[model samples]
Target: MATGFYTHPDCLLHDTGDGHPERAARLQAIEDQLIGSRIDIALQRETAPLASETALLRAHSAAHVAAMRACVPATGQAEIDADTFVGPHSWNAALRAAGAALAATDAVIDGHLDNAFCCVRPPGHHALREQAMGFCLFNNVAVAALHALEARHLARVAVIDFDVHHGNGTEAILAGDPRVLMCGFFQHPFYPFSGVPPLAPNMLNVPLAARSDGAAMREAVTREWLPRLRAFAPQMIFISAGFDAHRDDDLGNLGLVEADFAWLTRCIREVAAHSAQGRIVSCLEGGYALSALGRSVVAHVRELADL
Candidate 1:
């Protein structure tokens, strides 16, 4: 079966203003690279829909949803925090970004697709249950994990995040859930820092020092993430895939390269094949440097699509 590719044009409409790294051009770069590499040809393309309130409620408080909707300006943009902003179209764009995650989960879990990738912006893993921050409005992966458990009746699930920064919000939302096992590495002593203490017994957050390279990442996966993930024996796997850790990206000091992303994806695939029946759902998170982001995503999708 083809790998499902979920995206929506509306994602570009949620502008972050000039000089912001999380701009619309990020998604364009990924698409352009996929097209240039002909990876798009093998994908099962699907337009992302608007996520329902019921779905959002699974990961966010109703008050949080109402507050975010109120923050959307009728025109121009509204800043939700130092790093997050909402333009007139942001509400719809956020819904579609999150909806794409849910749709990817359904496609993979229902056996309609082998696995899926959600190319979304306003990158999640930062937004909490009650607030938006760090360039995120909704926890897309968190929403999908909840949907997989409640809607699909899956008893166990796992979330692996590999952004340059810790998934503070994802942990804030999913830390204590007995059905979820969250694991990954991030550059510590960085922005929104809060994963050092292993938020909950279920969270396995490894901190990478500044300038740490692919070797460090690989070691963490082998020594920390994989052992816990294997013991958990999740029925499905979700990835908060972030490429900002790339050495080419100026946003962070991590030294990861395209090959590193491929290696990690392959590792995740192996875990899925062992316990999840090859089920995996990956969603785009943070990657600033355009060229690096594009190439890294190509490598990741190549592994995911097994092309």
Candidate 2:
């Protein structure tokens, strides 16, 4: 089981600020841990390209893309919302982040790799079609899923989001599309709060409480996610992988550890093997606490690599 690792130095250029939870150091921590654990050598390392305007437009409005480009400051950071910002190099970083997911989708589907993990920043699950929020710039996983459907011509696809926060942006963009099945468990009554009732039938979003533990998450996946995923039998699977749910992470109150992330990855991988020809593309989302984030990502990737 080959796993392609996609990233770029440009991703580290999206400086969110000194004390911001979503900073370049998050990617640095993951890379450091990958090297420390000797997982870096087993994966295929690739540079993420800049996403084309065509690809970005597939998931975002033209006005929103133009607005994001215009918001890039010449030197300092310009706030998109209270949480989202655009710095000098953020445009390129955002493009690369989205591009990584697109490329990974192509790689996995084309059989260059069995699966892939994109470790870029400016996470995209929160960005809406007409707006950017929740530290997200350009819905990377959403763009990739669209690319797989439109360009690659895949019949059906599944999106699995295990982020602590609801992927309201993804649901907003992908809802009601019969070709896609979106499933996930997120902390309810949390930031951007929008997953209780579900936007559409295709969206199987399970809302966990503030202090939910891994046992709760596991139960949700087993009872809610797995059955629908198997029934969908998608041609590919995309993961909006987030680690902020870790107990050590101050961002959210969920009590998941590295083992929990690995368990979740294994479950997703099993479903993919059974239905999607083992094609999986995972893109990073939210994870604040550095040490916990690094360990959790390594565990997730280890499962993806079957290591």
Candidate 3:
């Protein structure tokens, strides 16, 4: 089996704005890097389907999904927040984003792939169950976790979020769902401040100090996240892999580099190998520096694909 690469052309069509950080070029950068690497392992490229109503319901309310669909303007962009925007293509792109996650989960769990990477826009992490913010329309990782529990009949799943900002949306969606354990490490005192308050016993949210760099991140994983994750002994793993913490990325104060992203992937792989048969699916969340973003994603996916 190979690592599935899940994406769609419509994902690029979800345009933010000319100067927005969540631009289409971010996906282009990742695609270019992957193409340039020539990492020789079977690559399963697939078009992402729209997530089913049932899948959406796993993580979000039907009313929330309906309202998001309704907010899709006929021709122009709708500003959902100071940092969030939805153009005409936004609705379908978000669907594909969440859909790609579900597709990846199914691939790994069904023995169709070793693991998967979802490269889509409107990066999810800040999206709550009902509110869209922080350039996120849907909580992709949470949706994937829910799919694993409900559709795949998995008893327990886990979500590992290594983004610079906390995955407040994922927490909102999956909190108190005993079927899932979520371990998140994010730079503290950042935008959309949350993730420190544990919503459930299954949730392990580790907040690192700003400008802490990779050593601090590694420590958080070793001391905080890894123990909780291993204790939960999840049936599958999902990652909200965000690169905005990269030293070159200006969105956050953290000074992590590509090595940090690769290191985190290695750690996640270790636990997945031990407990979940390496069933891991990663989705793009936030990365502002296009060049660093490209390099970091390549490192992360290279590890996921074991290239």
Candidate 4:
């Protein structure tokens, strides 16, 4: 089976206004790099559908869903928080961003694809059950994980996050669930300031100090994430693929590079092959520095496609 690349044009309509790091240009950069690297022709590309209220309800409160709808502006941007904004098109974009993950999950679970990548936005992993913050409107990976467990009837699933920032919302939603295993490494003492001491036994959050190098990340993955992931033996895997930790990105002080992202993808792929029958779904979470984000995504997608 081929690797599926999912995205939608509506994702570009989510206007964060000027000077915001989480802009539509982020997705453009990745697409430009993919085309430049000629990786575009190697994978299957699909348009993301809009997520239903039923699907959104699985990971978010009905009030949250209603609030997102109520928050959508008919003309200009509406502020959900200091960092998060919703434009006229943001409602559709947010739904599609989340829907891409759901569609990819279905594709992978149905054996139509070996694995998939959802390159949509506004990025998730920061949005909570009732609150939107950190430029996220909904927890995309959490929504997908719950979909896998409930709709697809998967017994076990693992969510892996490597963003420079802790996936606090993901942890909040999935922490105590025994059917799910969530592992991540983030820059601690940083934004959101959670995950130092994990919320639950099912969560394995490794907090790295600012300026920590790729070596430290690798050690944490090998010593912490890998062992727990192997023991859990998940039936499916989901990745909160974030590249903000890249040394060039200013969003965080970590020193990861393209090679580090590739290595992490390889590790996850190996684990997926061993236990999940090679089913993996990765959704874009965070990555600033345009050049680094594009290059890092190319590296990650290349690994996902094994190209």
Residue 164 of model 2, lDDT score: 86
User: Of the pair 3 and 4, which is ahead by lDDT?
Assistant: 4
Candidate 2's error at 157, in angstroms?
Answer: 0.3
lDDT of 2 by residue, 25-101 (tens): 99999999999999999999989999999999999999999999999999988998888888999999999999999
lDDT of 4: 0.95
| Model 1 lDDT, residue 223, Cα | 89
* Predictions in order: lDDT: 0.93, 0.94, 0.87, 0.95
Candidate 1 per-residue C-alpha lDDT over 1-307 given as tens digits, one digit per residue, 9 for 90 to 100: 8899999999999988888899999999999999999989999999999999999999999999999899999988798888788899999999999999999898888899999999988788999999899999999999999999999999999999999999999999998899999997889889877898987999999999999999988988998888888889899999999999999999999999999999999999989999999999999999999999999999999999999
Candidate 1 colliding pairs: none
Which of the predicted structures, 1 or 3, would earn the higher TM-score when compared with the native? 1
RMSD of each: 0.7, 0.7, 1.3, 0.6
Off by over 4 Å in 3: 40-42
- Give the 10-residue window scoring lowest on summed lDDT in candidate 2: 77-86
Superposed by TM-score, candidate 1 places the C-alpha of residue 171 at a distance from the truth, in angstroms, of 0.4
Give the per-residue lDDT of model 4 (tens digit) for 59-173: 8999999999999988878987889988899999999999999999999999999999999998889889988999999999999999999999999999999999999999999
